[model samples]
Target: MQPDNSQPKTKPKIASSTTDPVDFDHAIGPDTSTPDGRREIRRATAASAMGNMTEWFDYGVYAVAVTYISFHFFPTEGGTLMALGTFALSFLVRPIGGLVWGPLGDKLGRKHVLALTIVMMSLSTFLIGVLPTFEQVGILAPVLLVLLRMVQGFSTGGEYGGAATFMAEYAPDKKRGFLGSFLEFGTLGGFALGTAVMLLLQVGLGDEAMMAWGWRVPFMLALPMGLIGWYLRNKLEDTPVFQELEERGEVQQHSSLASLIRGYWRPMLVMSGLVIALNVVNYTLLSYMPTYLEGQLELDPQASLMVILIGEVAMMAVIPFAGSLSDKVGRKPLWIGSLVGLFVLALPLFWLMGRSFPLAILGFAILGLLYIPQLATITATFPAMFPSHVRFAGFAVTYNVATAIFGGTAAIVNEGVIDASGFLLFPAVYMMAACLIGLLATRYMPETAGASLRGTAVPDAHDTGILADADA
Candidate 1:
């Protein structure tokens, strides 16, 4: 089926009771026709991206600093595995966070929930920098770390879905793919920043100082980032789509679990499957690659960091282009291509990564580039899977549940399987399996690239003609 790139010709009736006027001529939301309107959209994008960056910065720091974290928090015998386990443990609470925060976001507006979640997430990350080591507090240190990680995870449950929803709602429909890509751009930016900081400190401070105190510096930086995100978010009003919902009194009073399940089980399941592919590749490459390279491939820590940094920066550079391409093409095509590419190349790349340092860089770069299409289109694709009223709830609940189960546990799973069976290529095989699920999900996903997300009905439901088949 051909994609519709045109905006809807007729405007929805703007409620006369609204305090703020909405320009409905544009069809998506907000008036992009005026300079001021464009500026507001930019502001909204920045607000969304900043919060997203702050959330991911913590994950990136934690992923790269596993060695230090394990050293400071766990027993020496199997400290790395324990640290990874703690990382996985944080994700266990993500669904709980989603359950609480998602409905609140849908009911309360995006900005307030985002402001609270950012502060909570950032504070939790910052406190980790100050926590006493296992040497200082013994078992209590790991316990404390676990507590803080859970808080971060909980807050993030709301942060990501809300941020993406905000960004997607504010963006023009035709440019949604391009603009939404910036959110993931923030994601890669956060990972790159954290990795860069660790690399710089490692080179400047050396091993002794790094292990002693330098590691804390990256965690400490999170507070300021969070504060900046909060400030930006507060500067803007809620998203135009959300504002319209409020004005129309069409907003859901409560996005209850039973309601969401009964209404949106299909999208939730499809999103879950897509996320399995998205985040398994995500955590495996961005989060676990350093550990895998250093421990499995025997690359030095510095080299491992460099490889990931280069690959991430490359992905960041291409993300905008890929997102723009999705606008011209469609989200499903890119996703299908990426899933297929990864499935086909996962094992060979893993094999090549084991051969040498230069080959490792080549292998990782290829995998990262292949993964970019999926990453770049996340904010564009996922949020539009449901209508605006339940967008936040649908995205948060589905995404967090999937991520908690599969995405967050990726590192630990790979490590545990490798250790138990002595199979070094298990991560690659795991990614391939995830890609298969993504392919099936993509088959049933509605093509929403240029669809309006304004009303109560599912966006592009009639255009794609897949939901009925999916239900069947």
Candidate 2:
């Protein structure tokens, strides 16, 4: 059947609220005044940003600290390949962790999932700091290290989805995108902090001390931050959309794989695609760039991470503007624009940056700034796709699947390509490809920025039952 061109699309009758649906002036909580409205958005959004920064700190420390750990973990001079290889392999476990806990977030609550991940991450990180080295514990030491790394990867996989979902849900209808982007802000902020901490350690410690003890400090110190995040996540109220679903008996009682497949499968596919570019860029810029700078340019590891920190600071500033722009214009174009820009410039930007420190920082700042559009939009994008009942789970699983495939493998693929082909440009090409996929996907997905958080159950003009129910 050819798509209909004759019948004009009729929009639904929306209930009128005083505030503009596209711009959140005063739409959330009991606060209608500007001060109160901004306060609510800030307070709720802070949790996501806070949690994200802390967790990324954990992961970033791993990457930056790899230099310190190679000797201790592998101890054999000829086995650097084997050491980094094993460390990289732990990333594959991220998808499983995401797949396992993501659904629970959908069925249970974002806050619950967020809190759980904080605890798991904190415990694992602290234990990793204290784990016996291969020198003392024999072969089992590295094996245990891999196991703990898996736990950390798993926790990280859940962390973003829950935090993003929570922020999106709490954001007022007009400012959902702006609010949701804070999740990434938190994430990148954490990334910066981790790099900065490692930088500080390097400045103060000798090479021997760094390899011995300074490497452990970053992970061990996370205990207090994780506890603080857990408290904030637990104390926060659930999103208004999720609350409405619960009151209406709309929440799915079980998070069974079959149940999610039965109901939210379409969203699973759409969201996975919708959020992939950001996930790809997110990892490419945040995680892979570190090794790229340190390995390729032969820059000081400390200086390289510090340069990246400046880029992250730019990222933090750009996120809110992009998100707020989405509120004013819409989510789709902003997202597509970012992807398209990346497709066009990723190769040059990455290539130039890899050549010089000053140029590298400049390249990163530009890439990170343009990439902010995805960070701003996707936080609100996924939640808007599903009904409150299944929004949490649907968003979490799909987001994780995309991240696992594209995001988790970013560093691995970039490094592998660089290693195998002796071409340093693959990371840029890889980023471009992911963005192109996202550009196409964003074109067909429905617009939901101003749509009600509770889904409309009426089917589209076509007589598909599930689409009809989603509309209702």
Q: Candidate 1, residues 59-132: lDDT per residue as tens digits?
A: 99999999999889886898999999998988989999999999999899998999999999999999999999
Residue 164, model 2: lDDT of: 73
Q: Per model, how many backbone clashes are there? A: 0, 12
Off by over 4 Å in 2: 1-29, 34-41, 76-91, 455-472
Q: What do the candidate models score in CA lDDT, each in turn?
A: 0.89, 0.72
> Distance (Å) between predicted and true CA of 216, model 2?
0.9
Q: Write the per-residue lDDT of candidate 2 for residues 1-472, one digit (tens) a residue.
A: 1223354444342222233222212233535357866676676777777787778877777767766666778777634455455545556666676677777775676778888898888888888889888889888888888888888878877887678768767776656777777787777777888888888888889667888788899989788888888877776777765665455455556666677667767767777776677777887788777777887668888778888889988888888888877766667778878888889999899888877778988999999888888876777777677655556566666776677677767777777778789898888888888887887788676666644454323113232122233335
Root mean square deviation (Cα) for candidate 1 = 4.8
Sliding window of 10 residues with minimal summed lDDT for model 2:
458-467
* Clashing residue pairs found in predicted model 1: none
When summed lDDT is taken over every stretch of 10 residues in candidate 1, the lowest stretch is 9-18
